[model samples]
Target: MEARLDLAGSPVAGKALKHFIAANTALAGSTLPRATRELVEIRASQINGCGFCVDMHTKDAAHAGESALRLNLVAAWREATVFTEAERAALELAEQGTRIADAGGGVTDEAWAKAAEHYDEDQLAALVSLIALINAFNRLNVIVRRPAGDYRPGQFD
Candidate 1:
């Protein structure tokens, strides 16, 4: 399927995406674990129905040596036994952050407390930033009707 717009080709999007790419680069260098960041990105993309992001992050994570079972289980992480408590906490925060409207009061105290327990302040900051960033990406891709399944890991780089 064709995207409704070529976001990367547009001047408006180019400028905005430059800043976004910069922010992502900063996050890439953050203290958060790559695995947890990827899982959070994937989960948020899934919740937002942004197929392009799901394809991108999943492929990127796999190329970085993440296990297939863990990748597959991200969607069903709560029921799967493949993840550690830290990963589960991150995933829970990602879900609650992504579906804030559903929760009404935004991310609950329990989710934040759990995430705080698993992560140090810097990592927690990175996680919160990641959640916001991924949600923004999901909105942009979903808005532009970005197509999925052709993304190569590190294609953007």
Candidate 2:
């Protein structure tokens, strides 16, 4: 399926996405581990049903040495035994952040506390930013009906 609009071709969208991409780049350099960041992005994309992002992040994760087993289990991370406590906490926070509308009150104190237990303030900042950023990308891609499966690792870079 074709996208409703080519985000890169539209002047306004292109400009906005430039900044968004920059923000994402900065967040990538945060204290958060690369593996955790990719996992968070994948989990958030899965929750938002953004196939483009799910495909992109999964491929990117694989390029960064993420295992197929871990990538496949991201959707069912809670029940999966392949993740560490820190990774699990990040996934929990990502889910809560993505489902904010459903939860009404947004990320819970328990979730926040759990995440804090695993991550320092800088890492938490990165996690929060990553969640919000991925959700934005998810909404944009999902709204446009952007088809997946063509993404290559580091294609944007």
Q: Rate the local accuracy (lDDT) of all candidates.
A: 0.95, 0.95
Candidate 2 regions off by >4 Å? none
* CA error at residue 85 for candidate 1, angstroms: 0.5
Q: What digit string (tens of lDDT, one per residue) describes model 2 on residues 25-135? A: 999888899999999999999988999999999999999999999999999998999999999999999999999989888999999999999999999999999999999
The lowest-lDDT stretch of 10 consecutive residues in candidate 1 is 97-106
Local accuracy of candidate 1 as per-residue lDDT tens digits, 44-153 = 99999999999999999999999999999999999999999999999999999999999997999999999999899999999999999999999999999999999998
RMSD of candidate 2 to the truth, in angstroms, is 0.6
**Best candidate, lDDT-wise?**
2
**After superposition, candidate 1 runs with Cα above 4 Å error:** none
Candidate 1 has a TM-score of: 0.98
TM-score of each: 0.98, 0.98
